[model samples]
Target chain A: MLRTVLTAAIALAPMAASAAEVVSAVLRIERERPAPISRLELPAGDEGFMGALLATRDNETTGGFLGHTYVLHKAAALPEDATAALDDLIEQGARFIVTLAEADDLLALADHAAGRDVLLLNVSAPDDRLRGVDCRANVLHATPSRRMLADGLAQYLLWKRWDRWALVHGSHPRDREKAEALRAAARRFGARIVSELAFEDTGGARRSDTGHVLVQRQIPGLMQGLREHDVVVVADESQVFGVHMPYRGWTARPVAGDAGLRATAWHPAHEGFGATQLQRRFEALAGRRMTDLDYEAWVALRAVSEAVTRTDTADLATVLAHLLSDDFELAAFKGMPLSFRPWSRQLRQAVILGDGFTVVSISPQEEFLHQRTRLDTLGVDEAESACPL
Target chain B: MRGFLAGAVALLALGPVAAWAQVVFVTNEKGNSVTRIDVATLEVIDTVPVGQRPRGITISNDGRQLFVAASDDDTVQVFDPETMRLIHTLPSGPDPEQFVLHPSGNPLFIANEDDNLVTVVDVVTRRALAEIPVGIEPEGMGISPDGRVLVNTSETTNMAHFIDTETFKIFHNTLVDSRPRVAEFTRDGSLLFVSAEIGGTVSVIDPASGEIVHTIRFAVPGVTPEALQPVGVRVTADGSRVFVALGPANRVAVVDGRTFEVKNYLLVGQRVWQLAFTPDERYLFTTNGNSNDVSVIDVAAERVIKSIPVGDQPWGVVVSPN
Candidate 1:
C-alpha cells in the first residue's frame, strides 16, 4: 500500500554514486514448527510470514530513495531447536528478526542473539511474562499482551454498562492466563465477575455432525448454574469451546473475548480511520483477509522500516536507538500513531472490537482517560509495568 | 440546464443585496441540515434540511450553487444559495466524505471513503465521468491553483495522490502522516498542506517535486498529543499564515507560513472539524462538531470574536463566492 516518489536530493545524485550507496538491511522471520491442531481453522497462507512479505514490499516502495534495500529471509518448519537457523540468518547479516514462535522459543532465540546487536520482534506470542519480569532489552512485542486484550474488552463492556460477566474458560495454559488477565481487568475496571467455570476440552472431532448435538447439550448445561450476568466472557485461546458458547449459552447474553464480539489486533471488518484502504490493499496483495497475526508481523517490520527510512541508515545500533527514542512513531491506521513502550517494548495501538461482519467499536473508549496517551489506558502503563528495562 | 437558468435568474433578482451580504453554509452531520450564517451580522439566518449525514460541503465556482456531500445518502445535493432550495443531486460514490470542484467549473472530484475510489462527476449533467482507483479511505480533495493537478488524500494509505485532471491518472503520490483528513493547496499552488488527524502534524508538500518539504507539529500546554488531532487546514491567500483545526483540542492553531512556527492558538469550541473564510478575508469561521456551534475569528485580530449556535454536529463549512 506504500507509494513512493524519489526525493530531489536522491534524484539529483550521480547515478554511479547512487548505485554504490544503497544501504541494505536484511530482515529474518523465524517461525517454529506448527503447534498441535486445535479447533482453530488455519489461514490459507502463512500468516506471519505473508505479513512480513507484504511489509517488505511496502518498505521497498520508499526504501529505494533512502538508499535502502530490504531483504526478507523466512525460516519456517524449523526443528525443535532453531538455534542453527538463527545463527545462519545472523551470519547472513540479519540484525532484525521477527519471531512467530512461542514464548519459550522466543526466549531461546533472544538468548542465542544476546550481545550480538540482534533485535527480535515478537509478533505471535501474547504472553504477559514477556512484557513483565521476563522482558528482554533487545526484544520488542507487536502482539498485544493477554492483559491488554482483556483490558480492551473490559473497557468496552463497561462503556456499554455491561458490568457483570460470567467467566468461562477452556482447560489450556493460555486459556488460564487469558482468564486471569480478564479477572484482573474486571477488578481494575470496577466490573463484577459473577461466576467462573472451566470447560475441559474432551477429545473429539470438532466437525462431526454429532459434535453439534453434543455441544448444543453441553454448552447450555455449563451455563445453567451461573449467576445473573450481563455478558459471557469466554477465554478459550485453544479455540476448543468458545465459538460454540455464543448463541448456545443458556442465558441470552452477549458473548465476548475469543468469540462473538471479540477484541483483536486487526479485523477485516474495521473501516474506521481509513482501515478500508489497508484492507483493500491487503486483499489485493494476499488475495485474502488480513488476520491479526499478519497485522502484528506487518507492524513489526514497519517499525524497523520506519526507523531505517527516517535515520537513512542500516546500522543496527542507530536503528535500535531511534526505535527506542520518543521521536519514533509509526502510523498504522489505528486512529493513532503507534509507539513502543520503553519499559515493556509493547507497541501501543488501538484494540478493535469487531464481530465477523462489522467493527462494533474500538477500545480506549472516550471515558478511559490517561495522563499521557489514551492508548496507555488499554495496556500496562509505564508506572505499573513490572519490566525494569 | 433548467436549474442553472433558474439559479441565474434568482442571482439577478437578489444582485445588490446578496453582493453586499456574504453568507456561510455549515453542514451538520447529525442534524441532516445546512445552517446558513450571515457574515455581516454574524447570525443564523436560515436552517435548510438537505439529506442524511451531510458532512463535506462547498460552493460552486459561480457562487450560485452549494454542493453538500450527504454521506449517508451517498449523493451530493446541490442547492441554490440565493433561494435556499435544493436544485439537484449528483451520484457520489459510497461514503463521499469530501470533494473539490475543478476550476473549470464543470467537473467535481469526490473522495469515496468506503470504496477507495475518487469519483469524477459532471456537476451540470449530474453524470459520473470517471472513477479513479486510489489508496484506501480517500477523504480529502485538493486542486492546484491552475486546476491542472488534483490532489486526493487517502486516510489509510497516508498518501496524497496527485492526479492529472485531463487523464484522471495518478501522476505522483507523496506519503504524509497517518490518517490524513484534509488537503489544502496554498493560494499560489506552490505548496500543499495535508493534515494528519492521528499523527497530529501538517505536512507541507511541494506539488511539482512531490516531496514533503516540512512537517509542522503542534503542542499546546495541558493538551495531550493524542487529542491534538489535525483535521482541517487552511492557508491564507497571501500565504502568510496557515490555520489548522485541532479536532478535540477545541482550538485552531495559526502558523506562520514562512517560518512554519505556531504563532497563536485561538480557542474555539469542542471538536472543531472545518473552517471557511469570508470573501474579503477579514474573518474566518470554524465548524465545531461537538459544541454544535461556529466560532467566528477576525483575521486582523487573530482571535475568536463570536460563537454562533448551529445545528447538531456541524462538520463542513463553505462561504458563498459572491
Candidate 2:
C-alpha cells in the first residue's frame, strides 16, 4: 500500500502547496535502551509515531474545513543511519520534522539541517543542554527538561512538608545528570538531602522478578541504616533500580523521582481538563495507553496544526512563523494554552506528577510565584535562560 | 386566646416562602452538598446532601423538579425543589458534566464527558430516549428557545454539534475555540454564544448557517492574558446584555448583546465560574469555586452587591422561578 502511494506521488512529480497539501515528518533514531524494571513498562514499536499519526487526523478535522489536508511521513533508523533517514525526509520536501532521539543524535540532525529551511521539534530529549547552553534557534522542544521534571516533583514534596530527602542515584551518565537536576531542585526549593548513596549497576537482569527471594532481600539492606529522611528520591534514568526501590525503602518513607511519584508530560489516568476524551481517542487509534513520548510528539505536531488552521494555508514558512510567535497559543489540554518561549524555543507547559495509575498533582504549586507566568517556575526562567536566541 | 393569635401570626411568617419570587441553589463540588438561599432575605435557607461530586444544578421550567449532575456517581439525580429530596435518577451515560432541558420540558439532553455521547432522557418516563455520539469530551448543552435544535459543545474536539430535536441526530458541526464550556442562545434563538475556557474567547455563531459572526475577547488591566478563561455564559432574556463568567480571572465580563463588544468586567470572588440569574433578571449569582462563595451581581448596575459564603468548592448555581 505504501509503495502504491509513493509511486502515485512520484507520478504527480511537481507537488505544490497549491494542491492544499501540508507535509511533515517524524524522524526517530532508535538507540540501544536499558530495560525498565518491569515487563509492563515495555514500549510499543510505534510509540512516538503513533502519536503523530493521531495528530495528523486531528489536524485534518479542522484543516479539512479550511481546504487543507495534513500528511505525516514516519521514518525510524538506528543511531548510525539517523542522518541518512533525516536526509531522505528532507529530500521528500518535509520542512517540519518532529524528532524522537537522544541529545547527541538530535543535535547532529539539527546541525545537518542547517541553512536548509528546516525546523526540528525535539520530543524526547530531557538533556538540559539542548535547551540551555546548546540551544538552537531552529529547534523547539516539547519534552520537559530534566530540571523541570525534578522541580515538579520537588515542589510537590516540599508542599507536603517533606523537606528531608534520601538521595539515591545510579552510576550512569544520564542518571548522574538526573541526580544533578534533583540536587538543583532540592537547593532551589529549600529542601535538604539528609542522606546520599550511589548504586553501582552490576549488570543483572533488568526486568528482575520481584518475587525472587534473593533480590527482595538485597534491596532492603541498601538503605538500612540511613539518616532519617522524609522521602527517598531516586534518579535512575538508565532504568537500573528506581522502580524496584518504591516499596523497599528502609524507613518506610515514600519514593519519588523516576519511581513512585515521577513527573511527566502526560499520564494515561489523567482525566482532568477533558483529557479523558483525549486518552480515549488515542486508545481508539493506537490500541494502547498514550505514553509520555506519544503525548510530546502529539503536542509538537498539533502546534503545526494550530498554526496551519489559523493561517488557512499549507505554506510551511508561514505556519512555522506562527508556531514560534507570541500570537500563537494552542490549547494543549494542560489546563491552559501553550506557546513556545522566545529565548529558548521550548514549549512552556505544566508538568504532571503521577504514580503510574493516577495523577498526584500538577506543579508550579500555587505558592511558588513568578512575576511572569507560574509555569516559568518549573524550569529555566527567562532571566536565567542561557540560550542566546 | 393569646396562644391561638400567636400561632396564626407564625403562619404569616411562613407564607413569605411561597410569595418569594425565586430562590438560589448552589452545588458544592467538593462538599457534595446543595445550598439553598432565600431570595427575599438573601439568606441561607438550607443545605442538603446530594450525590458525589455534584455539579450542573438546575430547576425545571415550571419549577417542580431540580436536576443535578452527580458527575462522579455517573447519574443525574432529580429532586423535589420544595422538599429537597431525591426523586429518581436518570440514566445519564457517564460523567454528565452539563445538560439542557427542552422547552417542552419532556427530554433533557446531557453532555457525557467520559462516554463521548449525549444521552437524551425523558424527564417524565425517567428513561434514556436516545444516545447520540458526538465529539470527544462533550459538554455545554444548549437548546434553542423554540426547542427545535440542540447544541452540544465538546471541549477536546472543539466543535459545536447541532442536533435536531425530532430526529435526535447530529445534523451539523461548527468548529469553535478550544475547551468550550458553555453554549447559550439568545431569547429569540437567532444567535448562539459559546465560551471557550482555555481559548479565553467567546465565538458568537449564527445557528442558522453555523457561521461564526463575531469573536469576543476579554482583557483586564491586572490579569494576565493566559489567566482570562471564559467559562459560563448567560445572555439576558431581553438580549441586551451578555454576561460571561471568566474562569480564574475572577471577573465577569458584561458584553454588548448586538455588537459583541466587551463592555466591562466586574470583579467577583476567586475563580468565578458558573452563573445564574434571578427570575426577575434583577440579580445574577456567580458560583465562585476557590473562594467557596457566591457573588450576587445587580444586573442593572453591573456591581457585585454581596458575596455569600457557601460550601466548599461551589461549582454551579441556579435559581427557581416563582
Candidate 3:
C-alpha cells in the first residue's frame, strides 16, 4: 500500500520514497606507487579508499531521507594482481565501480567490464589518451587530464603577464607526457616557449643525506643557459627535481607547472567557495588532509550518487544513462555545477592554482572564454574530437 | 533662557528613538564579534565581542534581546539589544551553525551541522527541551508563521524535514537540491522557500501538500550559472516579493511573490551569504563573506544604497523588530 502511494507520488514529482532499498558501489583501486623521497609525501594507506569511505557516508546521508542506504566496497589491489581483483569484484556482484588505476590497466579493466552491465568511473589516471584515442564508452573520468592541468596553469601564468616560459622536463615517460601537454597548452593559449630542455633521470638515491645539497647546485646548472623567460615551467610528475627549481632558478622568475605555483584538481589549503567547511568535515572524518586522488575518488562516488538520487533508482544501467545525459550536474563545491564533456566524458572542473599553501587563482582565468563553458577552455573541446565514442 | 534649556533637554531625551529607530546586528564568523549598525545613519555604531565563530543571529519579537549562534563555542549567546550586554546563553548542540526562533517565541531550533539532530531550547527555561533527529548536517531552520510546523534543511541529506511543532516529530521529508542553506516560509504560511547553494535554484513548496509549487532559477547577463548559488531567502510580510541571496554571484534576485517571476537582480558585495530586513521591510541588509562588509538594499527601490564595512567574515544579519 505504501509502495503504491510512493510510486504515484514519485511519478508526480520526486517525492521522498518510503521503500527500503540498498545502493552499492565499489572502488576498484590499484594501490601501488613508487616510494616517496620525502616522508611528507608518503601515502596514508587509505588515500583513495578514504575518499570512498567519506563519500559513502555522505551518500548515505541523502539516501537515509528516502529509505535508501549506500554501501561502498574498496577493492584495492597491486599492479600484478589487477585482473584477479577485477574478477573478485565482479563475482561479488559489483555493478557500479569507481576505478583508480593506471591508464593501461584502466583500459584493460574497462575492456573486461564491457558488456557485463558494469560501468567504471575513472578517478586517478590523468592520461589524455584514456579520454582521447583509447576512449571507452563505458568509462567516465572524474579527474582532469594532464592537458587540462597544463592549460589551467598556462592560462593563469599568461593572465599574470608571464607569457614567456622556460620549460624543463625529466627523462621519465610521465614527465615527457606532461611536458608535451605543457607544449600543447602554450600553443593553445598563445604563450611563447622561449626554451625547452630535458633533465636526465640518472637514477640514484633520491633521499640521500646530501639530496638538497646536490639539487641546489644541479638545478642552478640546468637553469644557467636558459633563454630569457618570464617563468620556468617544470614537468616532473615523478617528483625528482620539481621541488628544487622554485628558489634555485638562475633568474629570479617564478616557477610554475608541476612545481611552485602548480595547477591541481584539489589542494588541502583551498578554503574558498565553502571549501573550508568541506575541508573541516573531511579532516574530522579522516583525521588528515585531503589529496587530489582522494578528491577524485570522492567525486566519482558522488557522481554515481547524484545519478542515483536524481533517478531514484539504484539500477546501474539507469544511473549510467542518467549520468551521460545533459541533465546531469555534480555540485562538488568548486563554485560550479560540474558536468561531463560529451566527447570525452571528462568531468569539467576549476583547476586550483596554489603555492602549496595559498590558492592563488582558479582557472580558466576570466579572459580565456569558451563557446559553451569557460571550463571547456582548459581541456579537450568537443570540436577537436579525437574520441570517436 | 529657562524655557529654552528645558525644551532642549526634552528633545535630547527623545533623540535616540526619533533618529535611530532600529538597530541592525551582524555576526562576524572570523572576527569573533557582532557589529551593530544604526539603521538611520547606515553606519556601524558598535562592535561587541562575542564567542568564537558566531554565525546565525536573530532578535526577539519585542526587540528586547538578540541571539547569536556562537558556532565554534557550542553556545547561543543572547544579549540585550539596547545595552549590547550579554543576557545569557542557551545550550546549543555541537557546532550549531544556524537556528530559527519559534513564532510563539519560546523554543528555538538550532541546527547542529556536526551532529545529525536539531537541538530545541526553551528560552524561558534556558535548557534544551528535546534533541530531534532529522538528517545529516542539518543547517537551515524554518518555522511556520502559525506555529504548527517547523522545517529544517540538512545540507548533506538534501531534504527539508518537516516536524510537528507540538510533538517535535518529523512528519514528512521533502527532497530538495544539494547543499540547501536556508528554508523560509511565506508570511501567510502558504508557501515555503528552500534555497540550495550548489544547485543554484530555490524550490518553493506548498505547506499543506508538502509539494514543490515552483522552482525559481536565477541568471545574470555575464555571470556563469555555476556562480549563482542561492543561500539566504527572505519574503515580505505582505507576500508580494521574495529576495534571495546568491552566494559567490554577489547578487540578490528579486522575485515576484505571486507570479514567481524574477523581477530583477541587485548586485551587492562579494560572496553574499545571508540577508536580513528592517522591521518595516524598507531596507534589506546582506552579509558579504569575502568582502567583509554589509550591503544595504533599499527594498522599495530595489537598489543598494550603501555598502557598510563590517568585521571579518560576516555570516549572518538580523535587525530589531520595532
| Docking quality tier of model 1 | incorrect
Fnat per model, in the order given? 0.18, 0.18, 0.24
Docking model 3 quality class: acceptable
- Model 3 / residue A303 / CA error / Å: 1.5
- Report how far off residue A56 is in candidate 1 (Å): 2.7
- How high is each candidate's TM-score? 0.78, 0.83, 0.92
Ranking by lDDT: 2, 3, 1
In model 2 chain A, which range of ten residues has the least summed lDDT? Answer: A6-15
On DockQ, who's better, 2 or 3? 3
Which numbered prediction scores highest in DockQ against the true structure? 3
Model 2: DockQ vs. true structure: 0.16
Residue B62 in candidate 2, Cα distance off native in Å: 1.8
Better of 1 and 3 by TM-score: 3
Stretches of candidate 1 above 4 Å error? A1-42, A64-67, A78-81, A84-95, B1-60, B64-194, B203-217, B220-222, B238-241, B255-270, B287-316
- For candidate 1, what is the lDDT? 0.82
Tens-digit lDDT track for model 2 on B1-322?
2432443466577785544335799999999999987786677777789999998888898898999999989899999886677999988777888989898887898888866678888889777877776765788989999999999997766778888888776667787887788999999999999999988899999999888999999989867777799998999998999999997899999999999889999999999889999978999999999999999999999999999988999999999977
Q: Cα lDDT for residue A125, model 3?
A: 88
lDDT of 1 at A51: 81
